[model samples]
Target: MKKIMFNDKFSLTQAVLEGRKTMTRRIVTYPLKFRGVNVAGYFVCKRPSGEVTEICMYDEDERMIDGGQILPKYKVGEVVAIAQSYKDLGYDPDSLDRDPKDLGIRGFMKHSAGWNNKMFVSAAACKKHIRITGVKCERLQDISEAECLKEGIEEHLKGIQYGFPSNIGYIGQYPFSNPREAFSALIDKVSGKGMFASNPYVFVYEFKLID
Candidate 1:
């Protein structure tokens, strides 16, 4: 098992570039556990432009959570199966097609046994956050807080979630083993584009179980 770290200095841009040139996807694992389960997932990088590319599924060593699954590794420039196209399913003809950044509200950081300080966005959040930053009450309707959190995690695993820009630096830190443990800390929303600093410029810290 490998531990992935997420911090202000983490170089996602470089990871994307390398993944694109090598045609290989990078798997980042964290040490945080969700609902008593160890969380694990990976993201696929698209070649050339190196935009997030695609998200695979969130899986655990024991079993699949939230309908998670294992994704086969693929090379860059190749079509990565990060997620299914809602448009392909033909949901609402009038509604605009859904993109990876239009999935949900709220952004989150992902940590697991393999990863120590890595941040992740939910698939739904990644889809929505990419379209627009901040929260949208309308899109958040009919969803429970737990569900919202899931969206952030799913998106993060997919790599669509944005992190701190190169100019920013770490502001805060915390520690936890599960979502419940970090709930209070995570509830405090950071006011920034990435996971480094909040709008007020407060520092947040969190630590989770790795073993």
Candidate 2:
């Protein structure tokens, strides 16, 4: 039972539930000191925890250079739960029904803002879950057009979908100019302020919601 956080106000979480999102990319916690795929077609690094990380490394040339294998956090076929707010999961212990006099500091703490924070949610208590179907390593900027759609950003050039967020960003006019442009804005926000510019190697996870 592992937990995954999509706490960006549940927009990403909602994408999972709606089947609009099926893929996610994460930055490798460990640094990949090498560039270009090894002669075997990949390269390896290790996390502080000693877990191996194999990344699909390279710039423009796909010429083989180095490679190794290890799934650091999640592996194929592993089912993980979405970390959600306690209130959304209906696990509020206080439930605001206790007598005000009986409720002390500890009781009030249960009702604190942290209760609704995704980091504190447990996998066992989650109602939504997703199973990892695939995993791979690639440059964050190498994401494909189809991959962008899988990440839950819709295209407005064809026309906006009903009940979806307006496709508005500094990248383009009325929806992104293209999938990669939209995805650039998305990864930057999700990973960091300049993630797209950094173009770091990342682990891509393809999953399906099982809730």
Candidate 3:
């Protein structure tokens, strides 16, 4: 089994637990003098041997950049644990049948009193697990309109969108205008500042909660 973590600030972990978020993306950069593409292009590229394939990145100016191997941490169909903070675990030390044991907190001491970071949470303690259903490579900005929603971009909708009764056209009011822009802001927070502007290559993983 593998482990995947999300930011608590954005309530992403909560979203996954509620079955709202089904996909995630992680950036991959070419070390030293390597960089990359836009409008979320997808191309089927084959190497000279016709055995290897890769997605080429393009800059804003439309110049092609060769992105080195885009490797993913988890594979399709693999079961992965969704990490959670110890405080979020709902652990009741007083109610447990057994005595207190190491919960895998990094600086945890018997007398210490603080919540454990999600990264330190052990596999056995993970209450939520997801199974990878799909994986693909794409540039950060290449995300589709639908993909943005899958990334768990929060949307607050006002009723009566475009004077129509349908719920599909409601405008989002979650600080940002719509899903893609909101997702751009989110990736930067998750990855780092300027990551969205750089439009780096990324591995997108689609998954579903199993527990």
Candidate 4:
């Protein structure tokens, strides 16, 4: 199994905790690129001679890739540990910083206090585990409003026009009426400018929590 870190700033960790998020989109860095569009369960590639096709998200032999290293996509049934902040056995949040003696001090023992810090928790400390149920490749802009909701788009609140409601109990994630527009804004916020406009290819995974 492998792990992916999620920050609490955007309420993604909260969304997962609330059981509102079951799907996620990951950007492809393009080092390991594949040609063609995914149709049904196969990737159809057009060549000069003819067309080449293969089952999407899998090698020719259908064996799954181990999730230890960066890869093109996660396979179905592969367990993914969601890295989050919380107290658990077999790990010490106080050891995250330079001083081990700073146990009772604020911002030292609490992983929740240091939101921007990089944290490596034991697999036992991860409160969430997901099993990939489906995977597909497509342009980022291809996400629909329905899909956005699956990405954990929450309801609206005052002041904020759109977006996933803030952690303090705000309304939504963006300032848009619909989920698709809200999702566009979300991508902009998380990925920065030129990202949504670039419309880069992305790997979208559908998953369900197993723990």
Q: Which stretches in model 3 have alpha-carbon errors above 4 Å?
A: 29-70, 94-114, 159-174
In model 3, the Cα lDDT at residue 127 comes to 76
- Write down the lDDT of every candidate, Cα atoms only: 0.26, 0.66, 0.65, 0.58
Expressed as tens digits, the lDDT of each residue in 5-87 for candidate 1 is: 22123232222222311111122323356578655562322222232222223453434343442222222223222222233
RMSD of each: 20.1, 8.6, 7.2, 9.8
In candidate 2 the C-alpha lDDT for residue 4 amounts to 90
Better of 2 and 4 by lDDT: 2
Give the per-residue lDDT of model 4 (tens digit) for 88-136: 3223555554223222334644544323332645444456788888776
Q: How do the candidates rank by TM-score, highest first?
A: 3, 2, 4, 1
Please give the lDDT score at residue 20 for candidate 3. 86
What residue runs in model 1 are displaced by over 4 Å at the alpha carbon?
A: 1-129, 132-145, 151-173, 189-211
lDDT winner between candidates 3 and 4:
3
Better of 2 and 4 by TM-score: 2
Off by over 4 Å in 2: 31-70, 92-114, 157-174
TM-score of each: 0.16, 0.68, 0.68, 0.62
2 or 3, greater by lDDT: 2
In model 4, the clashing pairs are 156-171, 157-171, 162-173, 162-174, 162-175, 163-172, 163-173, 163-174, 164-172, 164-173
Model 3 is weakest, by summed lDDT over 10 consecutive residues, at 44-53
